[model samples]
Target: MAHRDRISNLPEELLLKILSSLPAKDVAVTMVLSKRWKFLWTLVPRLEYDHSMYQDDVDGSSRFSRFVHSSLLLHEAPFLESLRLKLDHYSCAADIGVWVKTAVKRSVRELDIEINSPSLSTPVLLPWSLYSEGCKRLVTLKLSHTTLVDTSSSSPASFTSLKKLSLVHMKYPSQDLF
Candidate 1:
């Protein structure tokens, strides 16, 4: 008798857990292992898109952008545990807002957005919706090398469940973020 394929027969939940531990790019690449894993990465709750990983390749930046767009569009997770984007290029301001909005709508618990578009004179403006109370479920938020345009006049606009917040090299419309 032939031995059963134990690894391939593992429960979907277990397989997803294993895949979640890897970087998002690697997780997506696992589709070639077998047909069973072709769409498994879409269920992962954590996603990290870092453009710096492709700095050596001439077309890496554009490819990275495409990967992010496709992954976000196809993700089937009910709620995202984390969404991280570290972009170092220009001409993607609009897409950034859409991505963040999607994550916010999914009730993401952790969000890390670091933009390094030094080629532009001004930093990209982060969507103001991020500061809205709808994102109360967010536990952690980190922003770097970006601009935040908060036009709200409310005092103490806060994230109710936020446990951590880090802002570095960021520009804010005002000093009322406290």
Candidate 2:
């Protein structure tokens, strides 16, 4: 008799569940670990990008932009249940908008945007689709170090499936956010 080890033994559903626990960056790295997991990450339902985790984001270089851009490209659409992003620098704002647009089109269940901007003169604008019909499926949202340009046109959005929300250092005028 011969001993055999195969990913098939782990079960497809079980693998997907385990992969879901990892962030988008980790998932991307894990794909190279084994051929079995090449597409395993594709099925994961969560995506997280924290700029703080990157190396030397303080300089506000194009590296941050590339990081955000790469994450969007690596991630699949629609099925993403959560998208947590941290942009600590203004340099990445332009790329952040593009990333948000892609995620919004997918109808993500939760959106966590942390302004990685440490210091800035003027406020940055978030991709203003809150009033658009495309983002109706978005239930939960968090914006830190950011400003909501207009609330009048924005629909009443909440994390329908969202159970908890956290705000770190960003400031907003809305009394409703706690």
Candidate 3:
């Protein structure tokens, strides 16, 4: 009697659904399980990156940033179902912009970004790409501690499919922009 790998034998869709429930970092670790799982994480439609989880590390900020970049770059899902980012003061505006742009490009249906940086004078600015045509598929968008400037006059910041929007401590350039 030998042990059989029944889990691996399951359909890829089922495996992907299982992986989606886990954090992006934990999902990525599944790659080492076996050859069958080497690229499974990349196909998972949901990604959650929480910087607070690595606070105990010596260089957790940089490590977390790198992990986020790598994960987004490697993600192969045709349409991302969700993208959630919980960042701290160490995260830079440039990195945040890039991450949002990547998510928009992936046609992410749900986006939740929260930045905790009370000490900083200025918050990270949301990228113009977020309001562009690429985000037409976005269903839910939640933002916190970020500046939103209506930079895209051409696209007009439309979220046709958006069902829910939550903003917390978000700065806007003008009342007219809303």
Task: Locate the minimum summed-lDDT window of 10 residues in model 3.
Answer: 117-126
Query: lDDT by residue for model 3 over 1-178, one digit each (tens)?
Result: 9999999999999999999998898999999999999999999999999988764348545888888999999999999999999988888778988999999999999999988874444556677778777788999999988887666466577778999999999776674644
* Candidate 2 residue pairs that clash: 87-116, 88-116, 88-117, 89-116, 139-158, 139-159, 140-159
lDDT of 1 by residue, 1-178 (tens): 9977687799998988888777788889988878898888899998988877764347535777677889899999989999988887643777788889889888999999887774544446555657778787999999887776655557546688999999998766465543
Clash counts for all predictions: 0, 7, 0
Regions more than 4 Å wrong, model 1: 1-5, 55-61, 117-122, 152-156, 173-178
lDDT of 1 at 105: 86
lDDT of each: 0.80, 0.66, 0.86
| Global fold similarity of model 1 (TM-score) | 0.81
lDDT comparison, 2 vs 3, better candidate: 3
RMSD of 3: 3.1
Candidate ordering by lDDT (highest first): 3, 1, 2
| lDDT per residue as tens, model 2, 44-109 | 777777666667646546564686687667666446688888666545445666788888777777
